[model samples]
Target chain A: MNVFADAIAWIFSPDRASGALPLSEAIWTHLAFTVVSVAVAALIAIPAGWLIGHTGRGRELAVALSGAARAVPSFGLVLLLVLVLGVTHKVGASTTAFVLLAIPPILAGAYSGVEAVDRRVIDGARGVGMTEAQILRTVEAPLGLPLLIGGLRSATLQVVATVTLAGYVGNWGLGFYIVQGIQIRDFSQILGAALLIVVLALVLDALFALLQRVALPRGVSAGRAPENEPVRRRRRGPTAPAPS
Target chain B: MTWVTSNLDLIGRLSVEHLRQSALPIVLGLLVAVPTGWLAFRFRPTRGLVLGAVGLLYTIPSLALFALLPPLLGISFLSEANLIIALTIYAVAIMTRFVSDALASVEPSVRQAAVAVGYGPWRRFWQVDLPLAGPVVLAGLRVTAVSTISLATVGILIGIDNLGYLFTNGYQRQIVAEILAGVVAVVVIALVVDGLLVLLGRLLMPWTRGRRAA
Candidate 1:
């Protein structure tokens, strides 16, 4: 009870604000890390993913790579990068690690989004004399837009959560406060910093959810099962045999 | 490499602790999520609310969740319970949606046939729905296990002892080998456990064999 009160009070206090790393600054820094990393990742991954999906090649390799990547612990990745690259280049190393982490989901989403579009539809587009470029731009990109956004959404969320750890490597971000709080054993400070992160994450999630909804094509939205159902089912792979 | 060879005992101890920390949450999460997911599946009105809430829960950052748990649960910051409880919360949040989906994926006709053949709701779930839902739930469990095992490493930030300790210790010491040891150890545990789950699925669901390439 008192802890909650103190946390709220701590968040609002000018004392905490006037310190070396202010809460507002932390928020911006955290967002910057997330934005920069995800942007770089999207630039690198989306094209490769589209090529793979459009040509229908290299999907097995991509899926296996992403699955393996998912198993690497984020904390270890951060530290390993910082160590390998040297602490002086910690910022670059951390960003590289974040980019590596973000790439898999975005790439998967890109290729799978295109792959999910009905084969008949693509064939129909081809019969109408649409160039491959026209087919990719008009037929595949728009229909696959929702899932591309989903991949972006998850990648953003992942980067946001991970940007908190940026402070561990001496980068200034919202995680700085949590790291500082832990070192000092200040429960209020830890809770307060965590609250800031939670709010940021939820706000971003809501924004992305709205984006996903808005991006949904009206025709598809009309017949689609719930928003998450398709995403879940896609990952179950082809081997999920129907009950005989 | 020498760091790893010299620290084998420490690494083994931490691996045991990591496995223990991760296992409880996976098991407890399935136990809790099953009923809740069944409720969401059985009841129409609560479906949106239940699924939406858990979806939001999944978005909460793992570190933030760990930090929030101590104050919210009135547990000491250093308690191992904090790590387990936070991990369990994640597992439940991740698994509930899968459970609901797994149940929903059960064939409607199969369910109807079970009901028509004199099975009560409880018996039908046990005999027909659950077995049918098993593969999907197991799939979700594998994902949850890998993620939970990976996420457990974050507890080192809050002072909990586990394989994650190697990360912080190595970072502070600038020992790249030590850090690599931690990463390899965690990944191996995840892979081995994931393999075990696949085997368990095969043994328990023999009918699923030769049907698909799992």
Candidate 2:
């Protein structure tokens, strides 16, 4: 009980800010790693996913790649990259690992969201002479918004969780306290840092869940949207909704 | 290459520990999740509350969870049990959702038919509902298995011995082969476990094989 109280106090103590990387700075650095990695991943994966979903090609490749990627432990990957790239380049190495980790969920979400839109609707849009790009922009994007956000939600959560690993490579983050505390056997510090990470992750998760709700197409939410049926997160072994 | 060749004994021991540590969580997770999932799936009122609570558990980062569990459980920070317990919590968090979803995947009419044919709830759940939920649950189990195997590597950070020791040790020693060995071993374990899961799913749910083939 006293340890718990001290952990709580540790989180709020002014002395915390006196660390090599101040507590606030550590948090921002963590957020920065998360945001930049996820953003870079989105840039590469979303467009590639859109292309795959639009053309209805390369999906098996996507699935297989993501499956293989998921099996690579992020910790080992980080250590390997840092070693391979040279420890002096730890930032690049860690960022690469983070981006790779973030890509799969976002890619899955992007492609699956677009694929979930009914084929007849795309046909209807085409029949009315909407160009490919326009249909993707106006029709598919709106209908797929909920799922795209879902993918982003998962990606963001994954990256946030993984960023806690940054300290292992000598980059500072909220994980520093936990990592360093473990070495020195400081239970209060470890618990406090863990508490911070849990709180931050949950808050972000909640925000994404809300975003998923708000971004859900009105028709889909109302249960009247046949065109967007089966918008739920793809089950682990989900076959790509068969292209009609 | 030289490092791996010379360190075969160490690698073998670490692999065995990794397998043991990861496998326990998957089994324990399934034991807890099935009933919790059945309850959440069957009871309308408890659905959101149960799901929301577990969903929150899933959000706690693995490293943080590993750090946080020691004091809470009144265990040593370096106990192998701490890693197992934390991974089990994660497996439950992940598998409970999948188990419920898997149960929900069974058609209502199928369940109704069992009830109509004088099958008691227990018999029906065991014979009909459970078999029907097998594929989806199996899918979820595969995910839980792979992830647990991978996440178990992080146990090294807390000083529990596992393949992840390679990562920390390799980094300090600048031995890339040692790190590569760790990554390969983890991936191989994941792939082997995943393959076993698929085979087990086929064995348990023979009906699914015909359906997929058709």
Candidate 3:
């Protein structure tokens, strides 16, 4: 349709390059918000989750806390922070909101990932005279890599989606285009911005999927091959409930 | 404190609107997801396609989706229907996956036992599979409900009436207390809904309680 064509053209238009709302600038800003927020969230959540998963204590509390946190609306949070902190620190307020949004999934992922490791493996390591730290590092960490990465992927998606809200406070990211477009009744601009967001999200998703595959332990990955049905079944045994 | 007390009636009305906006999508989502999920589960070939489509829907940014709907649906820009429909799409997208997974979690032996006992496919699904899947499905419902409640707040951006209205109003008037009030109300609503769903799930799945007791 003409609308699609116009949006595509608008994105590459020379006039846009020199303007205040450059396409490249918006993309970079969005990415920065996502990366910074996810990094901070990972720093806070991954450690807590790792400790909780490693100790196998306070799991219910962790899950409940994360669930409640996830339910806090990012939009309200952003506005509340802006109001309380004053718009003087717009970027800081937005980053705080993004970090809050990013934490729950990453925490859950890291916790669940470590928890998903077989206790028997941990026991085996312990029997071999390995210390708790050694067992965790040598056994649990490697096996849990896939899930840790999975949590990162979930966190990334959430941050990416949420960072767009930063535009509400001011001229932030791709959301600026959508918000401004709506205000000015410019459909093409809105569509163009949305198209860019979709493409970015899809790219990130594919990259994480590849990372998940590559992060799998070699034996576990090999066990997934169709010809290795017996091995596959055995590998799954620890996770699956025991036969009644 | 005085600000909240003075605006209690307005806050109550906004909370009601928020509930209304959230509840409709969940109901609609359940109605659509059940059949679609069953179809995906029952048919091997369509499973990947169905889930892939739904997962893709989940990735769309809420604001983009909200903006995209008016043009796509030919509705007025400000229609409350836009919010409901957009939220419903998200609910169905998420719920479908949960429904299929819940149904998939029903033990094969239990299903086989139902079949062996001379139950037809419909009878087996209704009497055995569905009840078995109840807990997981209810868990999904709780998640969906909470997320929807939060997402409904985004409706404020487009000038739709809800708790988000307070966020915008407070921002415009520079009233931090009012904005904080909105935050508290939204969080409370989400928690209440989540708790109610948990209680509802427990009541409906008495077998789960019995199993836990043993």
| TM-score per candidate | 0.95, 0.94, 0.92
lDDT of 1: 0.82
Give the poorly placed runs of model 3, Cα more than 4 Å off: A221-244, B210-214
Can you write out model 3's per-residue Cα lDDT over A36-115, one digit (the tens) per residue?
A: 99999999998788788899898988777777776777787888887787789989988888888778777887777777
- DockQ of the candidate models in sequence: 0.52, 0.53, 0.37
Ranking by TM-score: 1, 2, 3
In model 2 chain B, the worst 10-residue window by lDDT is B205-214
TM-score of chain B of 2: 0.96
The residue pairs found clashing in candidate 3 are none
C-alpha lDDT of residue A158 in model 3: 77
lDDT of 1 by residue, B1-214 (tens): 9999999999999999999999999999999999988877878778888888887778888778877887778898777898899889888887887788788878777889999999999999989998988887888788788888988998898788999999999999999999999999988998898899988998999988877522
Candidate 2 per-residue lDDT over residues A148-197, each given as its tens digit: 77778788877887778767777388888888888888889999998999
What global local distance difference test value does model 3 have?
A: 0.78
lDDT of 2 by residue, B1-214 (tens): 9999999999999999999898989998888999988877877778877888887888888888877777777888888888899989988887887778778777777888999999998999989988888887887788788888888888888888999999999989999999999999999999999999888888877887866511
| Candidate 3 residue lDDT tens string, B1-214 | 8899999999999999999999999888888988888876777778878888887777777777776676677886567888888889888887887678678777777888888989999888889988887876786677788888888988877779999998889988989889889988988998899888777777888778745310
Candidate 2 lands at a TM-score of: 0.94
Pull out the clashing pairs in model 1. Answer: none
Candidate with top TM-score is 1
Candidate 3 lDDT score at position A202: 74
The 10-residue segment of model 3 chain A with minimum total lDDT is A235-244
